[model samples]
Target: MPTSYVKRILDAQIYDLVVRTPIDEAPQLSLRLGNRVLLKREDLQPIFSFKLRGAYNKMLSLGKAELAKGVIAASAGNHAQGLAMAAQKIGAKATIVMPTTTPQIKVNAVKALGAKVILQGDSYDEASDYAQRLVIEKEMTYIHPFDDPEVIAGQGTIAMEILQQVPERLDAVFIAVGGGGLCAGMAAYIKTVRPEIKVIAVEAEDSACLDAAMKAGRRVRLKNVGIFADGTAVAQIGKETFRILKDTVDEVITVSVDEICASIKDTFDDTRSICEPAGALGLAGLKKYVGRTGAKEQTLLAVECGANINFDRLRYISERTEIGEKREAILAVTIPEEPGSFKAFCASLNKRNITEFNYRMGGASQAHIFVGVQVVSDDDRYNLVADLGDKGYPVVDMTDNEIAKLHIRHMVGGRAKEATDEMIFTFEFPERPGALMKFLTRLGDRWNISMFHYRNHGSADGKVLAGLQIPRKDRKKAHVFLDDLEYSWAEETENPAYQFFLS
Candidate 1:
């Protein structure tokens, strides 16, 4: 009986707890992208997320018997908060199961909403399993984050609001995808009512569930997903959402962490708001589409989805925004170790603003200098590289290299001249206390520590670069050690940056 998506959307129970957000024009972003940018201010919702609309709709639709039995749901953050608050409004007991690795800020926020918070495993799947088990034992209704029809219809209201508010001609609407609720709901409604307008979806390159689904013509689970955009770090799209997406969504695009950070800055400049990485995804995709198609003076809309983020994460976002915007260039160049070589390198820069410079002594002939320079455009970086190359300076572009940005820049000096048969590895781990100590404990005390580099990125995880001195004959043992560590890592023994300076 509820199969009519359009009728279900129109008849859905919502608006008591959810606000009809404004569609405001983003001046700064519009100027930058050469398109009239409009933002669907879903971040201004009561819960600071669009999740509330669907959560409340699903909760309100349940009969009195279901409400009396209570409700339970598993989420990394936003959905849990939304469901908890909705249950409170509906006078029902609520329980939320969250990953142990969820940020303290989000966990605290949900707890403050008067929900029973249960910390489960390290991922959403593990937490979800725990919650599902509780539903049977407690006889409670389970509120799904994105898979249910009532929930999708509730989110569809946002599309209805956008069409009513922004009646002007629109070229596209950009939506961010986690389990594909927002995209699926909006795309379905938009394509149904206004099929001429493009419905585009964006996702973090590291956590692209919707993209994976469209590729295989079915849902495909990802082996690993990045945690930077934790809100959308879903490993796979929902069955119901994917079903809707396949019919309505036009394209799925992936954006890097840096691009997401840059888009966050753009959002702040235009609306004076700071959005989480998942929140900025829509804007990031809109910019990418403009760049790819060279589209101009067209009306484009992006859903400013959520504002729940750790305040400390601003530092990491600010640091990478410049690179994302292509305003800064980080490079590795070989220069003579002589005194004048340093001055010559500076002269060749033509007095461009140097954002950073790190040098470590190399072999007798030359040293490698890791430099960061500010430029107005990408072409400026190319010209700088050409000029340095013409002057006989060997240069490598590290502007887009993850290793250089995350690890090598923080490590200015690390050499193992006397330590023979040394091997280096970079690792990423949860940033809790004693995490690094735990990692070291796993490595064992058998091999001597040759080099170590680590620093706080002020995000969810900590990065570490470590070197161990072991004989070539024991390389197989080292491989066995790495497999046991169970942390995300890569060996840099053959990396040129290590070879030129750290070796």
Candidate 2:
């Protein structure tokens, strides 16, 4: 079917019902991509999303009798708020079914809109199933999050707004795909009006329903969905929406979670608004596509669809953003377990500030240490590995290792030990430029250092673990030196490994 019917309906009412979101020229992004890039600021909408446009359009299209019977919807979050707000405005009852795992902030937001919230199942699919059942039982109209023709037509209004706002013709428009509703609707309208402009759909690699569906030539269920981008963590694309997107979208791209986080931070740098990971998918695709094709002088648009990010999650996003950009490297180093061995290892490092260090005595022979370093470019990584190898200490780069990335970053070795003349001390000091030098200088000749470990946890304060080998008779003198030290230190002299290995 021709998009003319949807276009006609949009012209008649959607243009007025939906807010005309801004399409600002992004100079920073343009310089990065070597293209004239524009951003559609749908994130600034009243509901902080483009979802309101579709939900309002769908509700407004229903007849008086249908509206009187009320509406039911299942959403991860944004859609529920959209439908609830629209229904309240139109004097219609609304019931929203959301997954039990949905964030409390989103659940409370829907409740604030006067919708009766029902928490069901673990995922959107399960909530959807419950909503479907409620629809049949209560005889309420089911307002799908992204499937109906009305919702699709409403979302297409974004294209109309983009065309009106950007004077120059666009080479392509990138939209984040969840159930394909936004892409299907926007592509249908834009392709019909501006056939030369290409429509691209972007999805999270971990939750790429449209990409998989296109590959299989039919819609297929995903075995697992990534929760990082909860807004687009869909298991399957909508049937009707997929039909429209299959032919309309020129390309589908899948981006990693880290890529999406980088894009989110990039958008924040440009606009200072925190965009949810799903909302940043379009920008991520723009970066990847522009790099791959090396296409310049072309006009491009990315939809900033939503900005409803959880405040608590911002810390994690910020921490990972630089890492995602390859601006930091984490490594595991195996150094000689002998006197002055650590001092020699420190001398081998090329003066780059040590970001983190952690070490624990594995046995009587050797120690395993974790280290983090900052780097400027990809070539710096090879140089670092070669430099360590040249120093006779081989390093295992954990920058790309999944297990090390997630768990090992926070864990420090604490193996069992037996007590002997060997004593373990924990020291805390202000992590400054020359703090390590002062500590080492203070205890220079008083004791023989048997083992040591230090790791900076992205903090200004420093914590160090040291193992000292001393004669049992000299314990009294060792206590006097430790007590006179300026820094805070604790003695773990009766440790099991101290007796078993050090003795």
Best by lDDT: 1
lDDT of 1 by residue, 256-298 (tens): 9999999999999989989988899999999989988999999
Error of 1 at 63 (Å): 1.1
Local distance difference test scores for all models: 0.87, 0.79
Reference-based TM-score, model 1: 0.96
| The candidate that achieves the highest TM-score relative to the unseen native structure | 1
What stretches of model 1 exceed 4 Å from their correct place? 1-3, 363-365
lDDT of 2 at 318: 73
Q: Write the per-residue lDDT of candidate 2 for residues 1-503, one digit (tens) a residue.
A: 53753564365364444578887777777887689888899888777888988898898889998988889999988999899889888889999999876766678888999999998876799999999998889899999889888888888888877877775768999999999778888888788878789899999998999999999999999987766777888999999998888888899999886778888988887877788888999998988788779889999899999987767667667766766655677777878788887777777776777777777676576766777778764578778888888877867776765435543455456443443356777776654457678778887866667667676432223567677878889988888888888666777555332332233
